[model samples]
Target chain A: MMGLLETAKISLRSLWANKMRSGLAILGVIIGVGAVIAMIAVGRGASLQIESHISSMGSNILIIVPGTTTSGGVRMGAGTQQSLSLDDAIAIEEECSAVSHVSPELSGVAQVVYGNRNWSTGVIGTTEGMMDVHNWSVSSGRFLTDQDVRSSTKVAVIGETVAYELFGSANPVGEIIRIKKVPFQVVGVLAPKGQSAFGSDQDDVIFVPVTTAQKRLFGTPFPRMVRRISVKARDAESIYLAQEQITALLRQRHRIGPNQDDDFTVRNLTQAMEAAQQSTQAMTLLLGAIASVSLLVGGIGIMNIMLVSVTERTREIGIRMAVGARPRDIRLQFLIEAFLLSVIGGIAGIALGALLSQTLVLLFDWSTSISPSSILLAFGFSGFVGVFFGFYPAYKASLMDPIEALRYE
Target chain B: MALIEAEGVRKVYRMDGVTVEALKGVTFSINEGEFVAIMGPSGSGKSTLMHILGCLDVPTSGRYLLGGVDVGSLSRDGLAGIRNSKIGFVFQGFNLLQRMSALENVELPMLYGGVPSRERAEKALAALKTVGLEERKGHRPNQLSGGQQQRVAIARALVNDPPLILADEPTGNLDTKTSVEVMELLVSLNEEHGKTIVLVTHEPDIASFSKRIIRVLDGSISSDEVVIKHDGIA
Candidate 1:
């Protein structure tokens, strides 16, 4: 081992003697590793961003929407067939084993007015459980109490976007807003939720009590009301169970026979989240595989240069062997030199990759995250490439006949 | 007992499908503390014979014994071990690693022998001092004059404290005065340090410095003669 170190020292000195060639050789590895890391990092960042957007929607929540039936291989929404009702929501909440909370939501587009400000936005009527189901929090004042629902009070909670548009720097609490010509006092303002992955403005909707919006605002009857019903399971693991129970309860409540096609669709947020995550994972794996091609090219470059180096340093190898160096020592010397080149390149590539990814995040306002395991994997892969690519040349060097090598011009 | 013994040694080279014999049934022996020179013209196989004696090449058919071990029967690593611990080499071209300083060049053999760094440093300095090159130890081969580079090579050869020192035309690249100086150093090393010396050269004046001269011609030893034995310079 010590002899190998001495040989490596001499080899490094030789490499340093020709600085331009050495630098160019290292540059090849650097570019290869750098390109690989940057490509994978960007791909991974984009995939994770997509995944988190989906995950932020909600974990245990499920949405039941009106379904579309196919005719002649063309699918069309079968309209509301009176399959879902407020009683179905109540029954699922009361009877289902996995159901944690359920809320019936009625939505419509309406012009909201506060003082001299008027903005057209989405208006929703729901119970207090809707806030908890969506994991929403009130930034100011309080949400509508059960007494407000029972009394059908004309009080409302405005979303942050509506509050910002109407009130600006003024607090919207206790302020009266007109929705469809009916005056309602703002009881709370929702915290900002930015935008969803589907480009929906989550904080652009105002909430009012279901009974007040159904009877007084929209004039829709209690049984023939609501656009969709949202349900939340106890946890992520209970989402499938909650979905099954809700479907069964709604089917029974509607008096639909077992042979008839269901009129409603149950969509679990956990399934959407899982789908998003799986696609991201697949994208990451694909990007990683593509990056490995560049690593292979880098390995080939190392092998080509090492072969040239062996030929160029034939006389040096002869001299070392003549001076008492063993064959293994000579081989190890070249291997170490190649390994050092690759490891150095790997570290530099990782740094450059991280810097570039962070710069993308800062400059473009993109979401990015780099895992520590990926860095370790990149480094380990480069070292392994070094060994794999360096072996043949080193072996060739060690196998040279000392006499013939000394005689080489 | 002789430190090196060669009996019925032969080396054949196959070049372009033709067999060319480099050494033919050469027999010779050298005892401890002996300074011998082999003289011949180009293509006389003196270099081939030197390579064989230094364990750099194996004879096709023969027996070579160094310190009672049959070197011809040993494996390549065994031969390398002998080269590392028993024989030191100096070359005509001064074969110092061009990138290494004189001190590092001198430390080469001991490094191969797995000597500790501190001890290798001490011995390398001492060997350089033996060649009167202690002050120039930090100079690289390209930085030093041809004669100085040769001296560094000699220091490297002696650093292992090997029993045998083999020089192949050691002064071939040096001027006449430098050649005499290098010859005097070799004579002194053989006399004062009791190192067995086997040098291959074509110069008759250089051959006279050794106590014995062997002449090779046509792949065979033509003559073996003992010359005047003067007390070597200390």
Candidate 2:
């Protein structure tokens, strides 16, 4: 058998001699690997964006919604019973060791009118601590103060989308907007936070003092009742403990018996975020699988071209045989040719795929991230494709009868 | 023992349930450093006999010994080793790899023989010089004339310095003038290098360049005789 380097040298010479044919043969592999890498990159980027958005929504958050209630034998869904109160949020903040901060929330949908523009958006009423609990910050004016809630001031903070819709590009601070025919002064405009993983417009809500909402806008008979309570844990590791402590406290405060279910439920945002993360990971793998089909097609293309190459070089094989090359030597030469084609094609594909990913980021403003492991896997697969696909053709070349191959025109 | 000894050598081809006998009980021997030519018309089984002698194909039934080793007993790889180290082959078409330069073509047999690159290069250059085409070593087959291509093929065959050189119509593709030149090169290699050569051709003038002629007709040898030589043996 010839030395591996010698065989490789011969193979490279032949491939260089027929540059056009070699390029055509490798093109399929290039496109196939390029598409696979790009698709994986985009999918990974999207998933990472989702995870970051979920965490940015608020770290270690637990939402407490009122449980179902029965009135006259008809059951009402969660958040309909009005079983939570401001005192419950205060007690949880002070009594639960795992709990760091708490805010009782009262929310409703209202149409706000400023001059001629009218836009429908969510209206949330909460205390001064709601901003810190939700990790929100005001861009222009100050957030609602403790004095504002104590005095029942009719001042509100607007989100970026609401500010844009009502005031265009003009600043909305100190402007008066009527919510449900009740005039209120805008105290601040929240900065843009983009979209949530659940496809909700996050920057389209308005914030007001909890006291002002109950007295001026809602005028509800239940004075201390609120929609839900939002709580924050000291850190991510304390979220589950915070949920358990709050559940026990609420259950005890509501005076529910051992056999009876509590009137409020605690929901762990971390668990929900983990579920969303799992789904996005599945989606990334699915996209990767779909892209890999093209690589298999590329392998078949290699096999087809190698078979043709072997047949085309039948006379050359005969000459090598006549000059005392063993069967394995002939096979190794062609196999090395195919292997080089794939490996070279793979390298070009990685470059092209990165460029394509950058193009996506530039053209459509979509995030694209190429991981090192993906590149390594794609490169390794290309080499395996070369060997697997090149085998039959090289074997056929080795098996040729020198007598017949020499006579072939 | 002679360099090559064959007794009761026969080859049968099975094609579509029909058997064709190409060589039937042929017996011949040639001493070391002898120049012999096998002459026959087409379909006289001369090529088949050459194939068997070169170890390119195994006979169906035979007792053939090359360099005192039984050719029929060696494995496939062993036969390859023997062919690589003991014999050199030249063909009618001057079967040089067209994509490689003449130097590379000449280096191929040595490459298969596992000769190191430095030695292979030196010996390839020396073989090209022996064939008097060392100046054209960098030219590809298409760039060279038919005669030069044949000379490159001869250099490729001589790079290993094998004891036996097999030439099957070495000048078949050349003109009369080129053919005479190629025949003279073979004669000089045989006389000056003491290399045993087996030439296969139908041309009487080409056969005259060798010391002995073996003529085959109907798959059997009809004549074996030494040519009267003006130029004596080396």
Candidate 3:
């Protein structure tokens, strides 16, 4: 039996002797492993980014929008019917044990003017609970109190984009802004939320009390009515339960009988976000699979070089065999040579991948994360590739006829 | 017991569907401590016989035995074990790994025998000393003369203290002076060390160094004779 140490030493010596050729052979593996790591890192980063966006949108939250209302057989889209209202949102929060917070909204696109600047942005009239439902916080001053909503105060909490457009670098708080020519005082600035999952700017809206919106800024078509209701479940697991309870309660309140088409739709944003996340995960897998092909190509390259090396060193093998080295010893030496090549490539490729990831972040502001599992995967896979690809050449070398090999020119 | 034996041994080669008999049912035996040379021209089957005797190749027909054990029936690994512990091979090209130092090359046989490194190194060095090349152990084969490389090969063959030494034209690549030196070394190993030697060569002058000479012609042994040796001062 050949000792592993001796075989390793011999392989190292031979590979080192032909450093140039070995380096060329290992380059394929290096590129392959590097590509795998970098691609997976980028893919994981994208999914993580989406996850953060989902969390920013809030967890265990559901949005309720009115169902379509057909007018003379011309079907109107969702949110066209005045089905949901502020009273319904309040009832869900008070009645359903699964429902934690509620924020009913009456929102529209409107032009707001402050100083010499005028900008068109989303104007959303919601209660103080909107902050908790959306997981949003105030950057400065304070959010709306319940008293402000009840009193129908002419006040606003503007988002970062809205603040930037209206007040530039100056503080928007304590300043008054006109919405449809009606002045409303700025109370606080909403903390920045970059972009939504749908690629819409999130920090380009202003939040006012629902009462103030109905009375002052944008009048509603009916009293106690709202366009949508944002409901937060007590926990992530109870989101579906909360949705069911809300649906049942709304159906009973609206006096809809069994099998009657509902006048409202309850959407669990968590489910939508999960679906989006699943697609991202699939994208990541696809990227890894594509990168794996390069890794496979690299394994093939190792095999090609190993076959050539065996052919080149036929006499060397004969000499070893003549000296009483068994076929297994020769096989082991060649296998070790191939295994060492890929392992070396794996180590170097990891370093290269990390460098590439960092370069991407620096050059393109892409978020890249190299998970420990990905590293392990690339390294283990490369080693396996070495053994897998090295097998054929080692077998060929072992089965050689000593006399014939020695006689080979 | 006879240290080497061949009974009706024949080797046939089939290449591109052409059958060529390299050895024809020949039989021979050599006891312990004898130096025998097999002489032949190219394609005379001397090399093939040497290979079979060394356990590097198995005969197509008949039993070839080493130390009363039929080697033809042994498995590949079994043959390897016999070759490793019983026979040392000295090839015409001096078959030392080019990049290894003389000591490393000498250590090859002992390495396969699974000897510990310290002992292997000691034995390799002693073998090199016997060949009068102990001081050149640090030099690689390419750095040494052809005769020096052959000495390393001989040291490698002798490292395991094998009972038999097989040389396939051991001095074929050396000059006259170097050939004489290598032959004297082999003669000393046979006489002073009691090693059974089987050598393949075509030169009558070189064959004269052995106790017995066997000449092969057209795949058959034509002559087997005891040589008249000239006395050497050493």
Candidate 4:
């Protein structure tokens, strides 16, 4: 039996003798592994970005929007019927055991003027519970207080983008900003949350007290009209229980019969986010599986080259056998040669794929995460490909008749 | 015991559904430290006999023994071990790997025998010195003359210090002058080292170098004769 290092040395020497053939043979492996790495990296990065966006909204969150309505045979979407109220949010917070916090929101797009600059942005009205429900914290000053909501104080908290646009690197706290021509003092600036999954800018918004928005800014004819209610469950596991409890409570409060659909829609954002994650994961696996076919094709290439090598080295095989190389030794020599080709190709592919991924990040701004497991999977898979593909040819070489092979021209 | 013994050995080759009898009921024996030459025409099965002796091929119906072990029942790997430790081969074409140096070619047999690297190198160098090619140990086959390559082959055959050496037209590719030189080298290996040698050749001049000459005719041994020492080492 040949030692491992000796077999490797012989294989390397033979490969070096046929440098061009060996290089071309391993090219397939290189491309296959590289493609697998790059595709998986992009998919993982996209999923991670989505998960961050979902968590930024809040953990274990549910958004309740007013149900659809119809006017003159035209059906409107959710939030069209203003059935959600601040009292319902308070009821959910007090009566639902799984509920952690609740915030009633009345939001609209409006032009906010500060000093001499005016910018059109989303304006949200809620209580101090808004910060808790949305997992948001102020970078400067304080969020709206419960007293501000109860007394209907004219105070606003600006998001990072709104602060940037209205203040231009200056502190905006204690300054007055006019929302819909109603003057409100800036109480805080929110820490930046970049973008939502819907591609809307999360930082380009302003927040005010819900009572002030309903009484002074919006001036709705209805007394307790609310557009949406955001709720947080006690923990991730209790989100469904919270949803069920809130649904029962709202159905009773609206006086809807058992046969009738409730007037409001409760959406579990956590469940929706989880479903999205599952789909993305499926897509990643699919992409990875498709890319793995290239590795098999690369294996076929190795087999083809190894067959040619066995034929080319027929005389050499005979000579080694006559000099006392056993069948296993001969087989191991060729196997090691194939393994070397694939492993070297795998390492090279990783380097190449990483370079390409970084280039994508720079040129196209596409996120790519090269995880360690993926690298290990790709490298180990390439080694398997080598052993699998190289076996037939190596076996053929080992089985050659020494007498006949020695006589071969 | 004889170094090699064969009794009623036969080799029949099947080619395209037709059987060709290469060796027919051949029987022979050679003692240790004896130099024997097998001589025949192209179709006389002398090469077939040489292959069987070298453990390169198994006979179809045979009782052959090498160093008191039955060779016919040996497995492929068993035969390989015998080839590594008990028998050495010298071929007409100087079958050296093109990429390896003379020293590496000489060390190959010992390597298969699992010799350590340091001792393998030392013994290979010593064998090369025996063949008077020690200075050309670093040269590849293409860089050496035909005679030097054959000397390298001889060094390779002697590296493991096998009891038996099998040569098949070892000097066939050489000029008359070089053939004499190689024959002399083999003669001295047998005479000075007490190594047993068996060689296949068609030329009477090559066969005359051995102590005993066996001539094969029609797949059977036709004549066997011992050279008289009266000629005083031809």
Candidate 5:
């Protein structure tokens, strides 16, 4: 057997002799690898964006809603029964071991009028703890205090979108907005939270104290009671434990027996986020599988061209063998040539793939995160393609009858 | 012992489902330091004999020996080892690898034989100098004339210092004047270095330059003659 260095030298010489053919053959691998990397990158980026949006809803959050016991044996979203109450939120906060904080919220669509301008926006009613639970910060004035909520004050905080629509060039703070013909002072304006992944306008909302909303605005006792309860756990690891504790407590509070469904549903934001993440992982794998087909196509391309090359270089092979090149040496030469082509194409493809992903981020304003492992995977895959595709042609070349090849003309 | 010996050698080839015998019951022997030539018409199978003698092809039936070792039973790798260590080949087409410079081409056999790079370079240069191609050693085959390319090929054949040099119509591609010059160089190598030379040619003039000539007709040697020339040696 010849040394690897010597084999490489001969392989390089052969490639150099047929420079254009070698370049064209490697181009297939380059495009295939590049496309694979770019597709996975885009998929990963979109998935991450979804995950972030889910996370922005707040980690450790357990949204509690009423559940339905269907007579027809079908379970559906939230429940038809009004089993969830503000007292449950207070109880969970004071009783659950894993609970960090809890806030109940009531939301509705309402038309708000500021001076002569009127717009329809989401209006949420909740306790002051909602701000800290949702990570909402006030851009102007102050958030509603516990005193404001307890006194049933007719006060409100407008989101950035509402403020923009009602008082375009002026601050909306200290202005009065009419909700359902009930006047409320806008004590603060929220900072922009941008658009959510679902294209919901996060900034287009108004917040009010639940007591004031139930007593003055809607005028019904516990009117449109808390649709969902938000909860926060101490850390990421405590999320599952917190969910279990909350589930057991709510089940007991509702007198839920074994084998019977609870009257309310408690969901953690982290669970939703994990589900979204798993879905993205599936998408990434699917994209990678699709890209793997291109690699096969690229491998086939290398094999086809290498077969042609072997036929073309028949005389050269004969001459080398006659000059004392062993059969294995000839095989090594062709294999090394094919391998080098793929490795070079792989590197070029990686660079092109990175550039492509970055271009998507820059031009389309998409978020893309390229993992180092992907780069290694792509490169290693291309090298494997080289070896896999190169084998047949090299074997054919080595197996040629030297006398017949010499006489091949 | 003779440097090369062949007894009752035969080679058969199949073409398009028809078997043709290229060599039939051939027998020959050559001592060390002998310069011999084989001459035949196109279909007379001299080239086939040359290929078999050079270990490039295995004979269907033969008792062949090189340097006193039986070669007929040698495996492919054994044959390759013999080719690398004991025999040197030169072809009519001056089959130098076009991408390689003269020195690189000359160094090929030694490289294949596992010689160190520095020694290969040194010996390749010396061989080129012997063939009066040292100055053109850096030129690729395409950059050199037909005669110069053949000289480089000869230099390559000599680089390993093998005991036997086999030239199959080495001057067939050269002009008349260049052919004489190449022939003269071969004669000098035979006389000065005592290298055993076996040349194949169809031209009578080319065969006349050798000290001994064997003529093949109908796949068998018809005549074996020696030629005496005076005042041709310088």
Candidate 6:
């Protein structure tokens, strides 16, 4: 057993002896670890973005809209028929076991006039339950009340974008806004939500009472008809049951047959959102796996160079053995040489990978997050690669008969 | 007391399924501070005998004792320890590590023996000074002449101050001028330093430098005789 400093000195000298060869080997490891880190960062970033997007859309949610209408054999698309209404929304919320909350909505795009500054945005009429259904909150003032909806009060809550547009930086809760020249008092501002998965600005809408939108703002032909209903289930796992319950209850209420076409469609956005999230997670795994292939190639490269170094230094081994070096000493010297290569390469690769991820964020506007665990994993794996590949070469050097090795050219 | 003893030592090699008796039964003993040479033709088993005596190889069926420790009973690592502390070797090729400095080359055995760095360096420099090459301690093997390289090898063999020093044709690659210089150095190491010296060479001029000569033929000693003392160098 050689002293620690002695082994280190020997390994360092050997590595320094052939700078070009050692550099090339270290470069292989650098590229390998770097690819693993950068690829995983990008994938993790995308998945996190999707996660936030899904959360903004709210979870365990179902949106039901009116089915198509056929006029003179000309079929219209979804939401053409005014089949879903305030009554159906109330019945489902009250009757369905899996259903927790519901908000019947009548939405229309209208020009809003506030203090002579005008902006056109979608205005949805709903009750206070809209906040519970969307998991939304008010940043200032208060949301639309049940009293406001029942009395058809012209009170409204604006979103951040609409508030910023009409009121600038000033608070808009105490201001009055007009929709179709019908004045409504601003009651509160919805908290800012950056973007939806559909790439739409979620902070660009307004909410008012359903009765007011049907009666005052955008008048409908039917008395209590609504355009859509957003329903929330008890929890994530009960969404399927909630969707089924909604369909069965609606079909029975609308007097539709089992085999016949229904007047409304119950759509589950949470399932689609979850599927998107799952695919992004898969993409993360896929990126890491692909990058690890390069790492494997790098390990093989290490083994190849080590074998060459052993063959080149056969005479050195013989000389050392002649000077009373044990077989373990010879084996350990070369093993340490390789271990140093990989450990140094691993550190450099981690730095390179982080830099690469930052570069991607800067140039491509891609979101990237470097997890510390990945760094640890990469470092540990690289060290393992070094020792693993170095073993055979070191073993071969140790097993050489000293007399024969001395005689080798 | 005998510092090195061999009794009926033998070595057999099986290469390509052909048995070759590298050494037949041979026996000898050398006391402390004695200088001897084993002289023979090529393939006459002089080198094989040297390897066994140096503990680099074990005898097939005999007893070899270094400092009264039975060599045949030792493990490979035990042999290594004995070689490190009790014996040193010098080869014809001046077997110094090519990339290492002369000082570092000399420090190798102590490095393996786990001697602390500061003391190892001091002892290695002292050994280099003994060979009169302390100033060339930093020079690599390629930077030195053949005689200077052999001196460096001798310094390396002496750094640990082993009781026994073995030279296997130490001057085989040197000129007559360099050969005489090396032989004189070995003579002084035995006379002044009280180191036991065993040399293997084919040239009678080289053999005469030792106090005794053992001649080998066909894997066995043909004759053993004393070398009459004279002006030994050259």
Which of the two, 2 or 4, has more lDDT? 4
State the lDDT of candidate 5 residue by residue for A1-409, as single tens digits: 4678987888887877888988888888888788789878988897888777865676667777788656578755454666777778888888987888787777778899988999999988888778767778899988877788778899999999999999997988888999988999999998778887678999999999877876766554455456678888877788788888889998998788999877787766667777878888898889888887887788788888899999988888887888888888888888998899898889998898899989998999977778888888999999999999999999999888777787776
What TM-score does model 2 score on chain A? Answer: 0.77
* CA displacement after TM-score superposition, residue B69 of candidate 1 (Å): 3.0
**DockQ of candidates 1 onward, in order?**
0.61, 0.59, 0.70, 0.75, 0.50, 0.75
Q: Which ten residues in a row have the lowest lDDT in candidate 5 chain A?
A: A217-226
The CAPRI quality class of candidate 2 comes to: medium
DockQ-based class of model 1: medium
CA lDDT of each candidate? 0.84, 0.89, 0.92, 0.92, 0.85, 0.91
- TM-score for each predicted model, relative to the true structure: 0.89, 0.80, 0.85, 0.94, 0.79, 0.96
Which candidate comes out best when scored by TM-score?
Answer: 6
Q: Write the per-residue lDDT of candidate 6 for residues A243-293, one digit (tens) a residue.
A: 899999999999998789989999998888789879988998999899888
Q: In model 4, which regions exceed 4 Å deviation?
A: A110-120, A168-185, A235-237, B16-21, B229-234
Residue range B33-67, candidate 5, lDDT tens digits = 99999999999989889988899888899788889
The TM-score of candidate 3 is 0.85
Worst 10 residues of 1 chain A by lDDT: A78-87
lDDT tens per residue, model 3, B165-189: 9998998899989899999999999
lDDT by residue for model 4 over A1-409, one digit each (tens)? 6688988998999999999999999999998899889889988998998799788988899999999999999989887987888899889889999999999999888999998999999988898889999988999999999899889899999999999998999999999999999999999999988888888899999999998889877766597777899999999889989999999999999899999988999998878888888898898899889889998898899999999999998999999999999899899999999999999999998987788789889999998899999999999999999999999999999999999899988
User: Model 4 RMSD to the real structure?
Assistant: 2.4
Please identify which of the two predictions, 1 or 2, would achieve the higher TM-score against the true structure.
1
Better of 2 and 3 by TM-score: 3
lDDT of 4 by residue, B1-234 (tens): 599999999999999999999999899899999999999999999999999999998999988999899999999999999999998899998999999999999989887888988999999999999999999999999999999999999999999999999999999999999999999999999999989999899998888899999999889999999976545334
* Candidate 4 Cα deviation (angstroms), residue A120: 4.4
Give the alpha carbon lDDT tens digit for every residue of B145-215 in model 2: 99999989989888898999999999889998899889899988999998899999999888889999999
